[model samples]
Every structure is written in C-alpha cells, then in structure tokens.
Target: MPIYQLGQINTAALQTPGLYVQVVPPRTRIINGVPTDVYGQVGVASWGPVNSATLVGSPTDAQNFFGVQQVRKYDLATAIAIGLQLGAANQRIVRVTDGTDVAASVALKDTLGTPVTGATLTAIYTGTVGNTLQATITAGTQQNTFKLTILRPNFTPEVFDGISGSGATFWANLVSAVNNGLSGIRGPSQLAVATIGTSITAPNTTNTYTFAGGTDGAGGVTDSTLVGVDGTSTARKGMYALRGTGVQVLNLVDLTDSTQWPNISTFASGEGVYGFTQGPVGASYSTVSTSLNTAGVDDWHMKVLVGDWVYWNDTVNTQNRLLAPATFLAAQCAAQAPHVSTLNKRLGNITGTQRVAQNQPYSGAEIGAIVGARLDVISNPSPGGSYYAGQTGRNSSSDPTRNGDNYTRMTNFLALTLASAFGYVIGQNQTMDLRREAKSAIESFLLTLQQQKMIGDVNGGPAFSVQLNAENNPDARVAAGYMQADVQVKYLSVIFYFLVNLEGGQTVTVQVSSKPR
Candidate 1:
C-alpha cells in the first residue's frame, strides 16, 4: 500500500534497501539559493525495490530549494582611518594658547613669566586663579586673556546598517574637518625656498706704479745744460707720468723684510740715477705699473654685485616668514584628524564598540545569558521546533538529545545551531581583537614615520596587512560527527591603508579575504 512510503520517497524505486533518511539533512537543504552541499541529493526518501511504482515524494523540496548565505569580510583600512580621525579630534579638544601680544608694552617676558628684554614667551592657561597677574602702570600691562586655544580633531563613524558609505569618503570628510579646525590658528608670514649656485675664483695680489718728470741736463749752466743740445733743449726738473690714469693695480710688499729697498748712500753716487743728463747715458728711472683697472669701474662693479647677492639671499628669510604658520597648522591638523577618526571608528562599530565597552575581558555571565536565551528559543514551539521536538524524550528536561540519532548527531546539530546563531558575534569579536592589535602597531609605526617625514602626500600614507590566527580560538571550535569533527574556520587576512594630506583631502582602501588555516 503506497509502497510503504518511507517518509516520502524521492524516486519511484529505492537505490538501497536500508539507509537512514528524513525529508533531507538540514545541512543539505538549499539556503539563499545556493545548495548547502555542492554535490548531494536533497529532500525525500527512497527504499525497497529498485523501481517501485507506488513511491511518492513532496514537490516542494525539488522545486523550492534556495542558496546558502555567505558571510562578509572585515574592512581593516576603514578601521585605521577612523582610528586616526579619533586621535585628531582628541588633539583638537586641547587648547592652543597665543603668546604674541602678551607683553608688547612691558619688555617681553620669558616662558616663566619673568620680565625680560628681547625674550620670547609662550604659555597655556586653564583659567585657574593661582598665577593671575595684577594690573600694572603700562598701557597694555593688563593682558590677562586666556592663553589656551582649543581645537577639535577629525573623526567619523562608519554606518554599516545597509547604508551607503566607504572608508575613502569618510577619510576625505575627516581631512576637511581637520583643515577647518586648524584654519583659526595664526600662521607665519612667508615660506622660504633656498638655492645655491656655482662658485668663482678667489682674490689674489696685484701692483701700482708711479713715474718722475725731468728736465734737460745742459740747462744746468743757467738752469741745466743739454750737452748735445738740439734746438728743443730747455732747463727744468719735474716729475713725469709712468702709468696711465685711473688704472686699477695692486702693490705687493713683504712687511717682515726691511732691507729690500735701495740704500741711500749708493743712490748719492749718481749710480741710482735719481737724475742724469742725456748724452751717452739717458736720464731715466725704473718703475712698474698695472694695466688692469683695480679702482674705478672694477670697484664699482664688485660692490654692486655683492649688494645684489645679499638681496637675493634675503628672499629665503622672507619666504620662511610667509609660509611657516600655514605649514604648521597643516601638519598639526593632518596628524590630529587621523587619530580622532580611528578612535571614533573603533567606538562606533558593533564588534569594536562592544569589545571596548566590555573592557576587553571575557564575561562568563554574558556568555551564559546568550546560551540560555538560545536554549529557550530552541525548546519553544516555533515553526522549526519540530526538528528538535524529539530531543525532549531522550534527555532530562533541561538537557535534550536528538531522538532518532545517537548523541553524536544530536550534539553536532546543537553546535551547528549555536554557530548559526552566534557566528557573526564571534567573527565580529575576533575581528575587533585583531584590529586592536593591528591598529596599535600601525599607530606606533605612524608616529615614528611622521617624525621622519617620509611620506610626502595623503595618498602615500602607511598601510598594514594583518593575518589572524583564529582557527584554534574558543569561539571557532565546535564538535561535529561521530569522530569529533572540529568545525574548522578559515583564517581571515586584512589589509589596512592610511593617508595624510595637508589640504584636507585623504583616502584609504582596505581589502579582506579568507583562507583555510
């Protein structure tokens, strides 16, 4: 009669006479349009004859199968960027005090507030009355303004509740926030850029010359006589020019030596020829001069050239004055924004926030509560309770086992149920822990890198790759099958990227993947 329909046979005939069967194993059922098993028969039963005409099966199992649901990977890059933003926001909350006009009229004070001349002063004030100064006689002496300035760091939370958002978008917004916060800080007047050119020859020594004028020798009879007098002979004694006018020259002499000049006694014998008549011996004196102009055009050109060089050199100072303030603000904002964002992100996300709230300690009470809730749901009369209804007969009222199969299948099924219920929670928690460690390491690296000033732009920020060893963790372990089949979970690898920008434009990308451990 109806071929002894063994829980509704799938085929008209059975392939084997005896095999354990149900509508189908829950694991074999389709979920989210994907068959749970890649290659396996799902639903209905078959037994008895190889080809039986009376066997019948339900149409729903074959026609209405769905696919299994897939889990999502964590976004590490986004987490890092968010953390940085949080740090920035925290930094901004601290005040920055100005010391510019504090002592303009009172001969400036040192950082200690002791009155001093030509000194620089900088201080922060929280408005406590302990160190308040009294009014003085000077016009601007009552400069009791608050010295502390407060800035808000950049930070934003990622909205993961089926909303549209990304790490890059969040970072861009964070950068903008930081820039805005820092814009209020006063900046330097100029920014300087320096350049050096090729060198020229060094200075050396040179000489100058002079000459003497003279008269004819025959004219000495009345003035002095010219022995071989031509009609042009005349008597006079004067100095004559030996070198051209306005010629530049250098005179070389050894200050340490005194005997280099001619002796006066030798010169009086007329051999030195201070004066002589023209006949066999011509009247003349030896002297030296330079051709290069060392004084007129040369001195003027050198002085003008040096003055121009000095003027060009001053540009660097000017530039520094112009750009110092803006650059300082930009760097401060950049650093602060990323830190704030990171903190906020960690606090706002489900896994991250929960772990942080719980203070990173495992709570047995919390775990027990969750397990108790799950047990209650499984025992209650829900639509899916029939699968577990038979368990009530096998064990005590508090602990039940599967009816048909031994405790092995029953335990496996329970464990599977538990996993299905809390898999997300486990993954989230594990991810949070790994992320915390990764972030700490990254932050340390970033601090060091910033000091080096290695990265030039926001696009070139630091990145991290994390490999999580989560397979052996308590959250992932579960019993299965007759031989204690450990439900193995795949390892998750995450890459985190970071960026810093001066103009409030920064972005980062993170990619995550899973692999069997």
Candidate 2:
C-alpha cells in the first residue's frame, strides 16, 4: 500500500445556539397614598408581595409556573393613575354663547340646580355701556343653558357754543346764507357764517357804519342801524349798511392777510409796450403814443450794431450805432457795393465798382448763394475737396436769420453730411482687392507675433504656420505644418493638394507633409 497516495478531507465548525433571559420585579401598590415595600428573589421559589407577579423562564421550566396564582393590588396612587387613563380615553363636549350685556352679580345654575365646574367663558363689551357678567357650565346634565343682562353707562353728550350764540343755530343760518348767495358769488367764493337768531340785523345805535351806495339815511336802507342823535337831540339816524334776509355776513374771526381782491389795472395801457402803430412817422407829441415805448426803444439801443445808420433829432446820421428798419435795409444794400469814392478830391474808385459779382444783388438766389459760400468757407472748408464736407449752415425758417432755427438746421446738416462724406471717402480709398490682401497679411502677422511670444510652443522656441483650406470642401484639404527643427525660414509652410476621381475608381489615398516654421 502506498501511504503517500491518501489526502485528508476537512469540514467547517458547527454554530452554537445563543439564548438569554431577563427578569423584572412586578410593581407594588401604595399604602395610604404612600408607596408600600415589597420583596422579590430571583433564584428558586422566593416571592412575597401584595401586588401581581410576572415570571419568564426557560422553555423547559415555563410549564411549571404557568398555573401559579397571580394577584393585583391598589392604593391612592393606583386609583389616580387609573382615573387619568380613563379620563384621557373619554370623549369631550363643549358649548359657546355671546354674553355681551349680562350683569356681574348673577349666579349661574344648571337645570339640576348643580353648580357647574371646569367651564370657560368670554365677553365682548362695547359702546357707552357698562360691564356685564358672563357664565359657563360643564355639567353632564345641563350643558346648553346661558344668561345675559346689560348695565347702563354714566356719560352723556353736550352741545358746544362760544360768545356768538348756540353753535348749532349759528351754523345752520351760515349754511343757508351761503346757499342763497351762490348766484352773486358763484361757486364757493361766499364766506359761510351761521347766526343764532332767525334773521340778521344791523349794528345798534352806538356803532358807526358805511353803506354800499355811499348814502347816509335811515329809511333808505332795507335794514339799518341807529347812527346818532339829531342836532336837537330828538331822533336817531341809520349809519351802517343794513343786514337783511339771505344777506351774507363775514366772520372777522377767520379773516387772514391772504384774502383775494379784484384787480383794478387789468387792462390799463402804459409806456414800455409794443404794438401796431397808425400815426405819423416821427411825432414827439401825438394823440396816440408810439407803439414802441420807452422800454422798447431802450432795448433797441442796446442791440444796435456798429456802423448802423439812423435818423436822430430830425436828421439822418450815417455810421450811427442804431438803425431803424428802413435804415438797416439801406445799409445792407450799400454794403454790397464795391467801394466808396473820395469826395471832392483826386480820382477814386466809385462804390460798387469792385464788388464781387456773386454778392452784388439782393435777390433771393443771390442772397442764398452768398450765405452758402460764407458758411462753407468759415465752418467746413474741405482743402481741395479731399476731406468730407460737414454741415456749414442752413436756413431753417422763412426768416433765415432766426437764431434757434438756424442753429438746429446747421447741426442736423453737419451730422448727415459728415456721415455721407465719410462713407464716400472710405469706399474710394479701401478697394476690395486691397482690403482682401491687407486682411491676409494682418492674419499672418498676428500668427507670427503669437509664435514669437512662445504662447503654445512646447520647447519654448518660435514655431508657427498659417493654416489655409476651403471651408466647405470635403475631399480636398490642405494644412501648413511648421516646427523650429527646421531653422532656414520662419515663414509659414504652404501645403496644397486636390482630390480627383480615377477611372475604374479604387480606394482613395490621402497625402500629408511638413515644411518650414
């Protein structure tokens, strides 16, 4: 027998049962509302208590104690605990009512004449009234009854009045007068004042007064006041304006300094005014004054231009600093002439001899041309027409000399013309062919600059190439590849190729290469 041929077999270990037990002592009862002492033993058969016992044992011993006698005990603590549990499990019921005006001393009772307990009540008291009593009940038999009674308050309202009279009567009369005066005063212009009496009366004999019509008699006024005693001290006369039915009275108490009054000078005419005139040309003292008053003439004086001709002191003065309309027009025409001849002397050029042909006349077209030429020269003189023409000036209104209209038109024309001229110049200078070549050169130079900056070079050396290819061509592709390994030329490498279909077509062959960086 060969002993070396035997091999031993092994098995895994078996698991043991894990069983355990715990015993807790049964609760004891209270004696006279105090806890009572009880004894318990865990080993064989030891037990002495006045309460119930709990026993748990191994499966083999469980049957022996299954029929053992058990008892439960109770005291004050046990009774309270049981009562609480019963109350929590029982259903609750409630009732509510408004007791706004009930008396505080009333005793509440249920149907069985039993006083209810454990009840809640709420009361809301308002108005000029006193407090009230509110009651609630929570008895099992009478849960639906309620009572309420109101108490009187101790306050009352009082009317207010001043030295004038009762406030209510005064206010009533005032409102009536204001309503009746609406036709004369219009809207709310009449002051409202109430009187204590049924009708308003004028002041008494001791008071002095003035009347609306400047009259001085007693019977002439509808309602009047006693003015004074006669010369013989026999009779009294009315001196104040009468107060009558529906007559408005102002209360001095409410008067202030800001009251409005009628203006007396609403349409008065005076100096320092301007309007149409219909009189002699030069009248120092005429029935109607000149429309251009003192103020107007003063303003004209301040605005007079130098070298203006004017008529002053009944004589015309050339070279005056103030010019009326006629004189201003004459001066303008004279300015268009060429030159002034010397008076009573050796020969000289006559006026208008050397005047520019374009500005010699005062016609509309001539004026327009002269003004346009002047503006072009001063504001937008483009040297030899190389620079674009910006806005020189414009005539905005029928009256071309109006300052605001002229300024606005000039500004608009300037902006529009400048933009148009700029576009024209750019189109003429930057042709399509030159722009294309320039763009290509700029792209190449940027790429070279980026290379010199070593932005993407792995070896910290200048190496770059321009990439060129048709954007949408699928079969034909070209790329310029350059590296610092070849140092002869730093220009971009050029790679170009085309795809062609062969006869009896076969698989295509792709070509790629590298050149200078």
lDDT of 2 at 282: 20
- TM-score, one value per model: 0.11, 0.11
TM-score result, candidate 2: 0.11
Candidate 2, residues 95-161: lDDT per residue as tens digits? 0001122211222222233332111111121111112222221211223211111112121211111
The per-candidate count of clashes, in order, stands at: 69, 10
- Residues 389-493, candidate 1, lDDT per residue (tens digit)? 110111101232211112212222223333343322232333444434433443443344344442123444333232333433334342321111222211111
Judged by whole-model lDDT over C-alpha atoms, candidate 1 comes out at: 0.19
Q: Which candidate number has the best lDDT? A: 2
Backbone clashes in model 2, listed as residue pairs:
101-149, 102-133, 102-149, 170-194, 174-193, 174-194, 223-242, 338-352, 339-351, 391-414
* lDDT for 321 (candidate 2): 22
